[model samples]
Each structure stands twice: as structure tokens, then as C-alpha cells.
Target: MGEVGWNEWLSMMSSLAVVLVLLGATLFGLKKMGLSRTKDATKNLNVSEVHNLGPRQKLIVITINNEQVLLGVTPQAINRLGNWPEQEAVDDLNQSIDINQLEPDFESPSDSPGKFQQLMSQVAKRTAERKKH
Candidate 1:
């Protein structure tokens, strides 16, 4: 194969430079138009927590526009499980009794079932109550 000449090298470099300039300009234009992801655009929406239920299922808590929303996510669908106002969520967090305290006691096998049932019932009750308001 023939060696590349100086002119060929120069032509290749110039073409590369032109392509880089175009790419940069496009990115800059997109940012100016607010088409690119920016803090301001996402300030009102945030994922607060995520819990994996199974290999293909998860529970996600997100805060949007001052409301907290619980979502059930599966491979095929996303469902809204519950919603609460931000103030209520804050009050719950500030309470002396933590929700984790109500979780099943892993150390005592016999206590686990009853505690788990209590926790599930409380969650169901809370969801139902929130739906009414």
C-alpha cells in the first residue's frame, strides 16, 4: 500500500475539525433552546426512593410538583399505587415513630408473620385514606 502524502493528512485533519465544530455547535444550540436535560427542567420532579420487589418489579416513590407519588413498576406496566401531599409526607417523616420500626422482626421467626400482616394492613389503610382526599 502507498504511504499517505502530507496533503492527504492535512485534508483528513481539516475534515475532522469541521465535523467536531458542527457537533459542538449543535450541542450548544440544543442547550440554548432548553432541549437538553438541565437542572431547571427537572427541579420539580425527583425520584425519592426505589425498592425492588422482584427480578422484574419495583416500587418507586417520586415527588412531583409538591406531591409524593408511589408507583408500582413492572416489566409490562407502571401503576400509581398512592399519592400524598408533600406536607403530609414531611409530617410523617418528622414523627417519633418510624415506619421501619413496624417492619417484620427478622430475628424472631414467630413474630415476623404477625408484624408483616400489621404492616401490610397499615399500608393498605393509609392508601385508602389518602385516596379519599
Candidate 2:
């Protein structure tokens, strides 16, 4: 390429400066509008639970100001399920599920059991056997 003259160099630098200014202004506008991801988006609400009903349906439980609400979500729309009532704390032992109590093939387990669930089941079985003896 031919040598860049002083005028060409100055023009190139001015163009770069204009681009930087526009980028900075866009960032500033997003921050002012509270649309920047750097700020905590869930400061006022907490997602307590989520259940997948089907490919396009989901159940989401959200907590805000110590109140919990259940929401049904689908591709088309969102609907309120109901308000979940807060319960008194219970012991962990009472919350434990017995593997033997689980129904055999309630649905096809091979469908969507992810790696984490598989590992957790293995761990739970080992722990339960250890507790038995």
C-alpha cells in the first residue's frame, strides 16, 4: 500500500474518535436506564422453584418480600397458578424419599434423566445402604 499522508492519518483518527464516543454514549444510556446486566436483576425477587411440565410448559415459583407465587409458563402465555403458603420448617429426615417407595416406571426414565440426576440417585442409594447397616 502507498504511504498514508498526514491528512489521511488525521481523518482516520477523527473517525475512530467518533466511533468511541458513540459507543461510550450507548453504554452510558443503558446504565442510566437500568438495562445493564452489571446490576443485580433479582434483588427484589428470588426464583424458589421450577418444574418442567412438557416441552413448552413450565411451572415457576417466585418469592418476593417473603411471599411466594406460582406461575404457569408456556410458549403462548403466562398464567398465575396460585399463591404458595409458607410452611413451618421441617426436619431433613422427614423430607428424605425412600428409593424403594418410588413407583416402578411411572414414566419412561430413559427419556430425560440427565447426568446430574443419575449421579444423585447413585449417591443416594449408597448413602441409604450405608445408613441401613
Candidate 3:
């Protein structure tokens, strides 16, 4: 085998560093660009919300308790939130309700938040505030 030269080692290292830097830059650029194409949820979007988010955007529908709740913006509304307490509560609730027993032909939103429900809730909350005054 030929003698290993210091210049060759430096050259190899320099090329590797450049490649790594380029890869990192590309990855960073991609991440910064927001590759997640999923549109913001629709259930909770109000007229004002739409105005704030700009017009003509796709929205996702979410059902909570058989009721449809429109989560506002894409980045604003999260599907899976990190909540340890909620997880535990869900596990406990699961233990109480047996899935096999409550067989149903169709699934509906029982507690889902509809547009009216949101309005009503807001009104009720405002009423309570007025009462406190």
C-alpha cells in the first residue's frame, strides 16, 4: 500500500465537513419551511377566527363527545397534546365504560362542540360575569 499523506487526510475531512454542512443546511431549510401540509382544524373556527387566519383555507373537523368541535388554526389546534393528567383521566374513564357492552350501529358526537354550543357557552360565561358585577 502507498504511504498515507497528511494532505489527503485533510482533503477528505474538508470534503466531509462541507457535505455535512450542506446536509444540515438543507434539513434546516426544510424544517424552517414548515413541511406539514395538514390544514388547520375547522370545528372551532369562528368568522373572526377566519378573518384572523385569512380567507380560503382548508379546515379539519374534530368530534368531541359526539359533537363537532372546529379547532381553529393548523399550528394553533393540536390533535395530540401532551397532558399526563388527561391521559390518566382517560384511562380511568375507559375502565368505567366497557367498549364491548355499548355496541352501536353508528357513532355520533354526544359531547362535541357545535357552533351553537360555542356561542351558548360564550353567552353563558359572559352572563355569569355580568351576574358577578
Instruction: Name the top lDDT candidate.
Output: 1
TM for candidate 2 is 0.40
Candidate 2 local lDDT, 23-82, one digit each (tens): 999999998898966778558687877766557555676877666666666555576645
Arranged by lDDT, best first: 1, 2, 3
Over 23-97, each residue of candidate 1 has an lDDT whose tens digit, in order, gives 999999998887865447458888987766446555677999999987766555576767889888776534323
Give the Cα RMSD of candidate 3. Answer: 15.3
Q: Using alpha carbons, what is the TM-score of model 1? A: 0.48
Q: How well does each candidate superpose onto the true structure, as a TM-score? A: 0.48, 0.40, 0.31
Off by over 4 Å in 1: 1-11, 14-42, 93-133
Indicate the worst ten consecutive residues by lDDT in candidate 3: 48-57
Q: Which of candidates 2 and 3 is the stronger one according to TM-score?
A: 2
Q: List candidate 3 stretches off by more than 4 Å.
A: 36-133
C-alpha lDDT score of every prediction, in listed order = 0.67, 0.59, 0.41
